[model samples]
Target: MPVERTENRGADELHRYYEVYETIGSGGFAKVKLGRHIATGEKVAIKIMNKKDLGDDLPRVKVEIEAMKNLSHQHVCRLYQVIETSTQIFMVLEYCPGGELFDYIIAKDRLSEEETRVFFRQIVSAMAYVHSQGYAHRDLKPENLLIDEDHNLKLIDFGLCAKPKGGLGYELMTCCGSPAYAAPELIQGKAYIGSEADVWSMGVLLFALLCGYLPFDDDNCMVLYRKIMRGNYDNPRWLSPGSILILNQMMQVDPKRRLSVRQLLDHPWVVKDYNSPVEWHSRQPLGHIDEDSITEMAVNMKRSRESTTALVKEWRYDHTTATYLLLLSKKQRGKPVRLHPEPAVCEDSCSPLDILHFSEDEDAVIVGSLDLSSEYIDDCPWISVTQQGFRGQPDGLTNNKNVVCEIWDGYGFCCVFCSKKDRDQEQTSENKENIVVQEKEVEIFALPLPRTPASSKKNARHNKNVLTTPNQNANAINSKPNAVTPKGKKNLLVIQQMIERLNQTMCFHRSRSLDMAGTGDSGKKKRGGKMFGSLERGLDKVITMLTPSKRRGLRDGPRKIKAQYNVTLTSQTNPDQVLNQILSILPEKNVDFTQKGYTLKCQTCGDFGKVTMAFELEVCMLQRPEVVGVRRQRLKGDAWVYKHLVEDILSTSSI
Candidate 1:
């Protein structure tokens, strides 16, 4: 008889079942590559984890795998199987050919409202499932979000996934998340509810999806933290009322007020004009996904898993699973590649310092000499711009406390606004010459480079005066009429003229209507009482004229006679007057009143950021202003009513 070859292979022989191709991606402890099934020509993503890299954190890796094993959702990345060998562990997952959502968003600059709604809906669905599984995906940035060929989102990267301590009131204290998407509670180093923290990240994602850039961002960590804590950001005017309403609900600074996943599902924007996939609707409703239900399901699953484990242990003659892992590793043999630990930052002597000063000649000051002796400096790839000699600076907005600093190719350049606080801290000429750097306060502002030719020329001139003019005070530099570009000035003038003309036309028409109503007649004013009173009484009279007898009597007349007899004129509150008064009181410096709403820079915050507000202007002018949404305040009274936005309004229409 011919010798029979056995087809059965143990878990250690995973390489026989699948063929690993070239590496596709990599992280600290794992490398992902394309793999093909031996039995079928199906392709899959194989994540190979080095056993040695796990060391003490092996349990966490196992937990992540276990969590993924239990998860089954259309929007979530699917984990097919786990295979272990002597030196490595392999995870077979669904292949997402479209790559990361980060790259997609970057290519598009920003997504339109329709596309954002679709992607965001899928994200929320995945998040709801993850939460219901009693797992918190601590890292939920765009990099963790993937896309398939069909344009559907696939949530991946479960390395930071974890179970909450308890059913309710459970808090996670780990300061483990991306700073850009981290919640305020997490940033403060305080314990935070995992679900609430996840909601906060969703808010950041939503804002970034609609706007091209992040809502809160800065080169300085402390500045970014402060902005996040204060919930300071501008509302993009292009967003619809519904979109703005939803964003406001999700991005609450207070976790308690932030919309939960269930609430988000039920929100108007999420549901409006939205047609859910059949699979999505077939799953349990959001209301069924509560903490208690998840807790019970988790307990049951754990119990079943334990019983299965016991049965397997008994079949293996009471040998623990850990022993099997060692046996499999020994069978495979050979050590995996060892990765170096992350490089440490040197905090000691010869620190890298960047200083900025304004002089008249448009020249930048570079004070620190590179230490060629230090290994750190030798390894540093920073290309010195000073070697190229001095070049003219770009012209742009230059004002007090409005400076921006940016770094390119390891060299730092800034267009900074010197504040009174900074100016007050006077230094000796010798001290200034030495370029002493301070740790606590780095006076850096990263002004964005001008894109247009006109702005480029303007910025170049402005930067010359800002950086090169040593004797010229910031006040003198700020006093130039060209402080704002001629084009910008012209746009503001056009917008203002548009508003003024609209106001004028409305006022003229309103006055004409009032005269027709006899309110403008001095003799009729005494008889008419207050303008509002006449309006109310006229409305009541109009209502009375609509009685059955009056209707029959009016029906018999010609169309013109019936029209004249059916309606009565009355004085009303002019929207033009309301807007005119609000416009009159607003500072001309940085305020722009547009049809959508108004935008103003907060003088009180001082470089914190700009604030944009959008409302139905006609509705606001007609009703009692009162308190509005998202830090909006309105002052209502008999004499004058105006909504007071952030104290200082900058005239720049760039926002």
Candidate 2:
């Protein structure tokens, strides 16, 4: 029985159809509520999200919805309906009672090898189906895997999934997901193939399931990263040899050496007791209609069969289609996995009549109607006809006047042609209507293109510069010249030559300034050139200002204009704690600051209170797990002063 909703009539429209109950889960911008459909009394998880709270992540939500809509499999969570309002968006999804796989793993401490195999097979099957549909689940972990009432695994949370339109060779540039489950390439911020990255995460998940802990874990994020990069993990002795082999293959340091989802499906460990092999080549057509489901929907909605079928075929995001799919899913429960269904046989004894018309202008026969049955018409409402002639015409035809005509629909096309003279002969022949049916070839999946060594080296160097730790800065700078191309090297050489000439001119000016100072008024009178003397003095002043001081080298002067004036301080504490520590010490340093989340903008005086300095300090995760990075930015200040201020703050804080 559904709960009575008499609280409010104007607040939510979803309440009219679904009886919303207590919240089951919540995130930063969304809350999942247990909802029951009023019409069929079905349990559902309704995710309610505020548009404003979503901000830039709204596109990710839309992508998740699109990916869910494209996927339909037993091991994948189904998206039932989506409702949007002016300020909010609601997504109704399948409710799993067994909760997350992470909780299940924790409760059991560790799963047996046989149980792990069962779960791993299901995950591989789902991944195969996902890849076949041209999508990759970038975020694969125990937390994102849901379990149904029957203890079957169902993949969820496709917010980070990728389906590139640039085909299989396209590389994903986003560095996402948890560090424990992330691949080495992703951690290094390199462009990676979506499927390969997913495979690496799957390896991590398998390890966690078998051992009850992460393969790579450390309090220091940098240490954890180094471990993952080197593929260092301890395999339990209790694990079988096959399991260990598969793990090593899946978690290979090189993505190309990693085993793909297809290969994993056929692995000995994965297929040990799994008798049913996934049919990777089979593709279910989107326009497929189920007669039983349609009949049930028609009865439940109290509508005509034709109208229900029309609504289901329309496939819009409305109540009728949602109810139809939900009912269909309910009927499919406990059934054997069916990748390909046998062709339907017509019950009635009505032969398909072909209606043809001859076109004199084109000198060809056009097929007007191939199948007039209600089912065929409903499946493909539009028809496109083509004419193709056989190599040899029948003896009854004169001058090959009659041509074979073919009719095409959405699913497949059929050919039907005959001559009036040989109509009886054709009827006597075993094949009627000379019809030939041809099915469209469906592509299974695309593999990634091979990468060259040169490209790989270039990407590695670029990624190093993009995401480099303080310890690697010196090495990166030293090796930078080797990465330059011939053209870049030539340009650098030209710039060096110009700098040397400038240095020589400055040296000559300095010597002239010293001589002029010693000679004083007598040297000016000897030169007798006021313009040249004044220009020489101006050049000397400029050179003096540019020269390094005796106490500090030129490197300690103002930072290069092109160089970024940022210092990233790594802290073991959380972002909030590090932020608080910095905030606590700012007041003591006579700095006025404004705080926004983990970022702070500070204003202070530098250079003996003569220059006002302003800078920003941001505490961020920087993609490192359990580590915080305090980054500094000189918004309006001397770079040299900002650098010292950052140093002072780090020294004063306990972070």
Candidate 3:
């Protein structure tokens, strides 16, 4: 299906990136067409709207764009890109194949308690996340809730969304929503909190989901308003007790008395079968990039990895970022891969004592044994290094009398040196040193075993039946040629081979670190001093780079604190005088404002006319006649832009 470019210049521009197909939906001002990305071949919903037709409702479109741009959630429909031509604006959105929840409910007539619970939980989760982001979905109905191919709910249509700059308590005067879903305060034309109004709509949505009909319906708008104001609605006999209880609390006529979105989350009906609470504020920062997605984009798009990374991190909703997101979504929909594979285990069941022993003769050094079970050995792989040649001779010995054996069992390292002469001299000797090396994730324990008593030694001699005389033992200890068992010798050879491999690995890392640190020939100078210093610094840098802390910091980048967006100012002037000063200053600063009493609704285009920033400023007289409060609320656009606008207004105004 090809798009007709004759009628729309926007379609002609969109045809360059997307292949527009049949119209999936149509409204009075805009039409949504099913389109496919030319580069990635993934389907998208392209909403085409003409500027002339939108006219007064253009700001609503801008509000929708701004809201969707800042929001990223699993249950929220994503806006990929926005293409604006001279005559039209094209918004590429996530294509939901399962259609609207309204149609689903109509087809089934009414949902069972269990099925309704599932859908309601998803709606609540999405709304909770939206409210936490400081925005409220004023028009939350089944028509705006879409179901995807996997039957998960996705909240859409943020045209009427508002972010109260004065926090949740800030009241909005807009009474524009579906009459059936509108709260009593909205119907009464009274100022109402956005979140509370949304809660009321959710209660109505809940009723429709379980009862297959509106709680308050009338052909006459006046009668409907009366019923809503009276807070009178019939609960179906089939509705559960928990459902009725929550519905009553949410549908309260007074906004202040109504259950809040946060409180509703813990309601019995909402929490039923919802064992795991949704993490509303767990979104990754915009600067966080997926390495796999970037790599795949680079390969498929024939672009450099560095360029693709920069584009994705910018998150400007450009062609490159859109394609990358599509590829990433497709990958996420596929089967999940395990992050860490299980380690392989050795089949041999030889004990540590057996592997440590090098000779079968009675005069061979008896190294301390590790009584580790086969299961324990299988769980923790061990690497043993035995250096037989001694560097220096010890006291009271003709030859070097110490055997140094180092064992690494994944988490810890142990080094032991045992000598027969030392054991005889001190029967109750115990020497142990524990050293923790956090960077290497290893703990070192150097321990020397105690000597056996005379009685135990005599019993060991009786059991072995092979005891050497003192003179013979002295010769055996001094001798260079001692017969080693084949098993022990093979194991000893393997351990020596492992030690060589470990040394090679360490050298490779050291060289790489030095090169990365740019310490070329200077790092190798003065082997005793400068070399060690350079090596230590280089190793520290390498270890820090490889640590999990670096990855964690990258993954959870700097988040935007909500407090910065909520701006308020105190003035000593009268409330009316302060508001008049703001109005007078806004026009000079290229800001437009519509005033009603002491409140001024202001808007401006920013980011080179790419974003439309809308905010509300209210001036209220304090208890002191000479003092007033100036409060600003961000209704739409970027938070930083709103902050700068408020600062600019305050700086230029005399108030």
Question: On residues 448-480, what C-alpha lDDT tens digit does candidate 2 reach at each position?
Answer: 111112233433442434212223323432345
Write model 1 residue lDDT over 347-396, tens digit each, in one string.
21111222211121121322121111110111111112211111111122
Error of 1 at 222 (Å): 1.7
Off by over 4 Å in 1: 1-12, 54-59, 275-655
Any idea what lDDT model 3 has?
A: 0.58
* Pick by TM-score: 1 or 2, better one: 2
Candidate 3 clashes between residue pairs 3 or more apart in a chain or in different chains = 165-633
Query: Tens-digit lDDT track for model 3 on 41-92?
Result: 5778888787778899999999999999888887899888888755567899
What local distance difference test score does each model get? Answer: 0.47, 0.58, 0.58
Q: Which stretches of candidate 2 lie over 4 Å from their true place?
A: 1-12, 279-286, 300-302, 334-655
Clashes of each: 24, 0, 1
lDDT measured at residue 121 in model 3 versus the true structure, 0 to 100: 78
